[model samples]
Structures are given as structure tokens and as C-alpha cells.
Target: MDRVLLSIGHGYSARALARLLKPQGWRIIGTTRSAEKAGTLAAEGVEPLIWPGTEIGPALAQATHLLTSVSPDPEGDPVLRQAGTAIAAAAPRLSWAGYLSTTGVYGDHRGGWVDETTPLTPSTERGRRRVAAEEAWAAVPGLPLHVFRLAGIYGPGRSAFDRLRAGTARRIVKEGQVFSRIHVEDIAQVLAAAMARPDPGGVYNLADDDPAPPQDVIACAAELLGVPVPPEIPFETAELSPMAASFYSESKRVRNDRIKEALGVRLLYPDYRAGLAAILAAERAG
Candidate 1:
């Protein structure tokens, strides 16, 4: 059985990946900042390690695979800054290492498509931090690093359906506004495939087939939920939180062809509609 170590494994994407990998006979070791979440992870059949610092444990040093979902903080990523040296010391044991990043690193493409070769021009502090972390991880000698630039990730419980049901959904219209998205399942599959291939120092974009207007996604969600579509408001006139407003300022279409062609992954949910329907069905069944 393959041994896998997840440095920041308590996230949505990491949890999903653990679930999928466990069934395939992989021994999973997951790190969590909280002791409570560590206990919860142990109960889920993963070997939970408390990692509140950047140090790497003996178990992590011996693991064959690693996945990091920790986004860099403005101050710096303690985990990467600290463990990076330790991991580099044990790089020979690592078969593959995956770093999760956001498509925001590509910044605004003016609704144009971008791929792995796109030069990074991150607009936000968070995006800049991620780019820095990517460079840091890639510097680890002998480690096969794979960077996955993920678009907006949606899945069963983390979709627009929840917002629509609560009547908080909004269609904020900004001209030339578009964003790409990928289902969480597809994210897991892509990461798993990348791990299997062990691509040395490669970057790949993870997005769905369509990059549509934000309003379109919201309208579709309302239609699927049998709720009235929320009224559209001009971007300039809409009241948005700082985080929400920041999203509207950028327009980029991320391409996933490299991941598809390299990993031979066929996305189960290619668009928001298919993903939303599956989530709705799962919710109803439960």
C-alpha cells in the first residue's frame, strides 16, 4: 500500500481526496492545526498528526506522497517556511508533492482563457502569497512538485443552492465578468491522477469546461431550486462585502486541457448545472 501524507488535510478538497484514496488501499496521514479536528480525522480512518508549526515528523519524512492545501498567509506560511527545509532534507523519500493554488494567480485576463503557461500577475495579497509559496515548494530539490491552480470549487454542500434556499443569492452583473469553476470531485480526481503520474515540477490549471457569467450560474441555481431568481444589480450599485467585491474586479477563463490531456481525466460534472443537480439529489436523498 502507498503511504500518503497530507500536510494541511483538514480542508474540503483534502478530505474528499482522502475519502477517495482510502478505498484504493492507501494509508493516509493527515495534519490538522486543531487537536479536535485531529481527533475527528482519526475517526475517519486517517492517521491524524497535530501540526501547529512548520516541523515535519518522522512519519511525514517516510511518506511517499504529500499534498498541501495550506494557502500562504500575508505574514508567510509557517508550515511551508518551516517544513520546507525539513522536507528538502528528506526529499529522496517523496515520490510526489502537490500544492493547491487558486486561479487568481493568473489575475484578470479580461475574460480571456489562460492555461499553465500563463504568466502569473496576482492582484491580491493572498494570490501573491500563493505564488510565493509555489516558488518556495518548487525549490525543494529532488521533490516532484505538482502545482494545481484551482478555480472556484463547488460540490455537494458548497454550492449556490444553500444561498438560494436562504434567499441570499444575488446576481451581480458586471460587464465582461466571467469566472471558471470546477467540482470538488473533479479536483480530487485530478490530484489523484497527478500523483499517479509523478510529474516533476509541473503546473496545471483545474477548471470546468465552461467559464460563464456569475449571474448565469445564480439564475441556473434558482431555476433548479424552484425559487425565484434573485434580481440582478449593477456591479457598481450592488452592496458587496470586501471579499465579494474583490471577486467582481477580475475576469479570467482558466483552461483545464493540460490536466485533461495529461491525466486523461474525464470530468464527471463538467458544468455548474450538472454539479448542482447531483448536489440537490444528494440533499433530497439524505
Candidate 2:
């Protein structure tokens, strides 16, 4: 059987997964919201369709696997709301399916550890919507769904390096404010492993072993670049947008035991230090 993947809301994380799958002879149909992005996707060998304006049924019929990276809004999940019926009709033929969710669902842990079994008690409105979307996905009968709740996502182009270079980096120190994160490469690997070993309804938390304060990561990146570290600013005094402030409202360390034990997955960057170094190295090597 041909290996075809229908990736809805194909964004950063989905692109990483595509890098792995495309090299392994998989055909990917990704959805974007713009014509320019569709052209870019096509350049990367992805078949892109403008979503919300396009019929997803034909793509669903072609897919042996499915993944949705779309976040929910005030209403609900876009994929479920728009193409829920097509997905259900195509469910039985799908070999595997996955959902990209945020660790924010287990909100306000006060820097405590949370596992897969942690009860969903989101603090933010965005987190609450994810909980709703997860429930909605679960309601779809016969869908081979696996939910991966990701932590603060950082990578080559989207890390502290960008902020430091842009002169907008700040070491915002909030006491006991620690966050778990995963390298984009590690996330891609874990997703690949899950597809290889499909276990429907499996929930995994994807994060690095290190759960350090935001200041520490900024310091590490600055040191790596041989530049002066950004000045530390207390969270209370930091002038932040509401969106940025919302991120500081929760603190937690997410456990990645299930991915290791169940899928035999090994992370490339187990800590922020290692992940930062790798990103910096990739830039220099390029």
C-alpha cells in the first residue's frame, strides 16, 4: 500500500515530520491558508491545498495516515468542525492518526511534574480549547488517534538566538517558573516512531528532560554566541503583550517516559543547553 499522509494545519512541527517522512518514500498532502504558502510547500515537494476554502475529502481518501496541528479557537477545532465527516468516513482505512496538542492543557502545575495521566485542568482560554478539541477528536468513532502534548517549542530559527540578535532578548525571571521543552528534531523523531508503532488512543508528552527557567536558556544561548547575556528582568516589571504574559501564567515539568518506554524513542536534545548548542552549531555549519 502507498504511504500517504494528510497533514491539516501544516505548520512548523508538521514540516519537521515531513522532512523525515518524505525521505522515506511517503507522499504528503499538507494544507495551508495562503497561495504563497502553497507554492512554498510545493517547492518542498509537499502537495498543499488552501484549507477552510478547499474540500479535504479527496485528500482524506488518499491518506493512509493523518495528522492535525491546527489549534482550536473560541468555537472549536477547525479540522474536526470542517472535515470531521470526511475523516470519519476515511478512518477505517487510515493506518495511524495523530494530534498535536500543547502541554498547557495540564495548566498551572506550579512547577510540579505531570505525566500522561495528569487530569486536564487548563488555566488559560487557549488551553481550555485544546481540552475541548481533544475530547472532540476522541468522540470520532474508529479514528486511530494519538495525542502528543508538546511543551515550549524551540528550534534553529525559532529559539532565543533570534531574540538576542534582534536586540529584544530579556531574561524574564519568575521565581519557580520552569518550563519543559523539546527540540523540533526530537518531536519529529517521536512522531515518526509513533507512526511506525501505531497504538490508537495513546497519549504522550513531548519535552526535554530539563525544565529550567527562561533566564537560564537565554544565558546559555548568549554564552554560546560569545555575547554578553541579556539583563535579567523580574517578571513583574517585564513589559509584555497579553499573549506573552499568558505564557508566564503557568509553570510545569512534563514527563516523557511514555515515549521512551512505549515507542523506544530517544531524544537528540535532552536539555535546553544541548538543544541550544545544536541550534547554534547548525547556524555556523551552514
Top candidate by lDDT: 2
Query: What is the per-residue lDDT of model 1 for residues 1-286, given as tens digits with 9 covering 90 to 100?
Result: 5566655655889888888899898888888888888888988898888786535568666688888888888767666666767777767878888889899898888999899898999887778888888888887788888999999989977889888877787899999999999999999999889888878888989999989998999999889888888999999999899988988778999888998899999998998889888888888899
List ranges where model 1 is wrong by over 4 Å. 53-55
lDDT of each: 0.85, 0.94
Residues 1-286 of candidate 2 have per-residue lDDT tens digits of 7999999999999999999999999999999999999999999999998998988888999999999999998999988888889999999999999999999999999999999999999999999999999999988999999999999899979999999999989999999999898999999999999999999999999998999999999999999999999889999999899999999999999999999999999899999999999998888999
The reply for model 2, stretches above 4 Å from the true place, is none
Error of 2 at 161 (Å): 0.3
